[model samples]
Target: MYNRKDKQLAQKILTFSCELEEGQNVMLQLVGLNGIGLLRALVEEARAMNANPFIRIEDTEIRRILSETGDKNFWKNQAEADQLPLMKKMDAFVGIRASLNIYEQADVSREANKAYADYFVDPVHFKERVNNTSWVVLRYPSEAFAMNARMPTQRFRDFYYKACLLDYEELAGAMKPLQDRLEQTEHIRLKGEGTDIDFSVEDQTWIPCFGKRNIPDGELFSSPIRSSVNGYISYAPSVYQGKPFDFVKLDVRDGVVVDFDSSNNEALEEILDTDAGARQFGEFSFGLNPVIEEPMHDILFDEKIYGSNHLTLGNDYEIAPNGNESNIHWDLVCIGADVYLDGEKVREGRTFITDDLKGLNPENLMQ
Candidate 1:
């Protein structure tokens, strides 16, 4: 039954997410063990579609070592010679990470990580694959992940499956009204515990993601017009790049981060200083995943916590570009936000109040 569930997920990934067709090339990248079951299933499903499936299994420790030791020229060559060429030949990409240690890269310097992102990640994956290929990235359930979620391994697996197997078609249907409202909205305000922020999404695209881009996905995202964001935000407890953060706060002025603080202030400073765009807002989104109600210290789940809102501090999606580009696209989540769209209160905390958008509230979506 466990492996069967994996097979079902693999089927969904190929058929629904990637939309893999016969003879198309798909590159599946797995970051750790414990996801071999799903990998096998993905291969099987891809072959069933007569699609060519290629696999790349990576070790986190090795990745950390390379990031720590590799230089500018090394990363440039790696991307230009290896990853970028390989990615260009692919029709779709699926990245599955089930790392035994999320903190494996903790000792790697921010400078090194930034170089890798600039030279390798930005050009190869973010620019080429993201804009060209049908791609989806997700974390596979494992004991390490369960520990981070603060749940028993078995219980967390159950939660994972339930969330991932949601009726996304129904959710997508439910999202239309909110999408309509957001598209028409020019100004927006968000208020919650220690959070009061305002931004503009005028003329920006509101992307409703239910199942295609991400598993366990239920969010509508739009990029803030660069230079339109103002005020401050207090994010919920979260983790980024394998480090835990608490009481993260940022004060923005004209879309740029003027002041920021967190449990590790030094780290926050380093991250924001990655590039000019790293200090500006790139994406704003509302979380509507009914099954996910709390933080797991993992952005994949926490950013989709029902009733939550998240903001990204770096690169915007090509589909909804704000012209703020960086090697990073970090998402910071905050719960308990009341949303106002163009001065009209549409959502009071976690519940959508407007008639047209009420279907997106958890109570209705749970049905």
Candidate 2:
């Protein structure tokens, strides 16, 4: 009952995540809506590969509970439980997201959510997850996500599915030129109409992650020094956790966000004020997927837009090979932005230098 596209998607997941090792234990957490089919297929694929797989499904009601109850202790306990066992047992973890609204629980007190968020992913958990497990964060489509992307539901769903089918190898190949440039550069600067930022990378800090834990695209990323950034960035008309932020501008000095400004939202203020570490830079990455044509307003999709890139402040997931700090992570994406490494233009306006890296082609993978 599987279509060829579905099979291709499964293969892409397996290849990119490096999940075929015999006797490896696999754990997957599926959020409601986006990744149901892919999760089902992935579970089966894991079994066929001789891996023991466990799956968990999380629903929106959980958000409702944390929001309505205002119980930080409950989430704290839950966080402990969720992470400790994974740290002890699982060899691989895969997260499949299909969220459209991050602020669905905005009604919850910011203080409570901040406490919960702070505790949810403990430092120990991050270290364990990053070091031992071969992990991946992948996307599935949903109506809410389609709306965020400004695309018709069916069309966007098709686009995501097609993107999922891209060949992992080809995508990595297309990114080699850019990776080469970034690896050789010591400092990279980002400037825009309302933003000017500069940061230095440790020698060999920028790394190219490919062939595992990523697919359909490859990116160059690094963990910047905790307090080394200087400048301002404005992200308006962007939504996070289902909440919209208008004209959000942040001023940075020595890598800590010194001043934060937002129009039409006080929630943004609360987020940055949560902790001293909240404003720290966590990860910097450039998107190499050429098929992603525009910003969908969803970090999962937008962060992968070809030639586009994003810098996440706070809480380095340690997903990249590089090391960064903090436990509060927020991704700010820039669309159609020009990306450079050592004065070489690797991407401009959503296109890579490689011609084959255009569009979501299964054969090319780079797109």
Candidate 3:
């Protein structure tokens, strides 16, 4: 018997998150069928609502081999099959990743990786997925994820679900104050140990993400004016594209990354070189999920850790078009950073200093 909780989660994604309507076509992309129970549940829910659901399963090991053998041309044209017609046809897309190994691609050479990513991965997969249909991406629990969180098997499972299946409706209701704050504010400043930065969001768009585009989402984002950023910022340890990096320090002046340093210098250079916009700011968001408390280097969780804030350096989101364009959109997180709105403290060290966000305080939420 499939677990009832898994089915419930699927129903939440289909009915609540994706909001699939009758006759809509939804696509499910699974990794190796590791979470087939949830997949089956999703199918049942889709049919019940008179929505059509289809699936595509991928094997990472096979892709790793392809990466080792394929050249630039191979990847450039790889997404032709799906990108041409199928992606446009889908009304919604749900991706479930249950990869057993997060470091499976760590050994892939940087030259090949960069070439393929620049030429193929960006235009084929990411661009369409973001611009065409409603999509939500999430990761299923694996031993690797548990280990990364430094928790035991059952303990991590509990933590994972607790974070994902949060009361997002309540979250949405409480986010109004912050959303309004960002919408009205023009100049925002950030400061913390090893970080101090200034940026202006004058006339920029503020987007509230509440478990729609990304699972475990509880943040509102805005774009920094392309020429209004000045100063340095630091970030916590994070893994990107199968590599571990930490202590990311960026030197930004007039909204450009002049010089940057990190624990992994080579990877840093590769990411910054992804495109022209890769060196500039894309998105700035405040983490509001009281349930997510720690940084385990997983962006989906860390970016939402209570009182945290993440700044992206790459392509601007479609919702908040910053007039910046790039194929890369990398989220770099700053833990315990104090955020200032018009020179007033609003967030400090994993807690909101403002009274409007009292509902988000840990004491209030856990109660």
Candidate 4:
């Protein structure tokens, strides 16, 4: 069952993600094996807010097929004819992800993943679908996910729920200083143990976004100039869905990932080698959610961690001031690292100066 707190949390999650407006039609996609209760609660919240809500539950087996079939033509056509229609019809979309098998099988084809990536980069549909929607992707805990996190199932859920309840306004406020700093500097460098990278920003390339009607968890993001990255980046081991990628070290030069090595994961190499644009940098963003604790090895969850951090490679949504090149956007998460714009540390391990921000309603700041 569901308790009042759980229901409240569900509503808050919906509110933060969808921000349903009166009379808008909201569509939610829930992975069938996880978070049905939360989905129901979200429906109720949408109704209460006078918005029409629709819920579609997807089976994990379908995902397995897409990951295994390497069926590009089918998905490419579907994106143009089917998914695009739904995007135009809906006011907003909220995706609730809960996977029963994160790494259902290690034998699945990396080529299939590449095929899907290629399909997304379809020029006509990518512009139409990505640019027109107000959307969000969020996560819920499941037993399989807990196993990957190496925590009890209940503990994982507790951490997830607690993180979701964090103050969005405070989180947004904390990111302002960093955003301002990025606006002032043309080049930013990232340095860490086993990682040293430098990337140049376009003269007028930064995107500054405030909270909008649909996306409540607001943050600033932009695409790095296509050929502006240099040096190496070592991705810490991460588990996606349920599959794990070994530590990956990429040697980037002239805005492209020219050389790459992974401890045990050859699939990453295959991805970067698939296309010219695939290896180039796509998007850069700083996480703003204060409630997100630490690196839990999940990109979706890790990117939302409170404090200031940036992600490069792959562009999905049409972020403001976007480079608008590749349709394949992959988000890489980094945490517990200092973020500097020019020379000042805007984020010292997740804490940002909140006093310098304007239009930040304190009443709405996250606790």
Most lDDT-accurate candidate: 1
Choose 2 or 4, whichever is better by lDDT: 2
Q: Count the backbone clashes (under 3 Å) in each candidate.
A: 0, 8, 0, 9
Question: Tens-digit lDDT track for model 1 on 321-341?
Answer: 899888788899979888899
Q: Which stretches of candidate 3 lie over 4 Å from their true place?
A: none
Task: Determine which window of 10 residues in candidate 4 has minimal summed lDDT.
Answer: 358-367
**Number of the predicted model whose TM-score against the real structure is largest:** 1
Off by over 4 Å in 4: 105-107, 118-129, 202-219, 240-243, 306-308, 321-324, 344-367
For model 4, how does the per-residue alpha-carbon lDDT over 240-306 read when each residue is reduced to its tens digit? 4245675667788887777887765566665555566667777776665544556666676665555
Question: What C-alpha lDDT do the candidate models reach, one value each?
Answer: 0.88, 0.65, 0.83, 0.62
Candidate 3 clash pair list? none
TM-score of each: 0.98, 0.85, 0.95, 0.83
Query: Which pairs of residues collide in candidate 1?
Result: none
Error of 1 at 134 (Å): 0.6
Off by over 4 Å in 1: none
Return model 3's CA RMSD, one decimal.
1.6
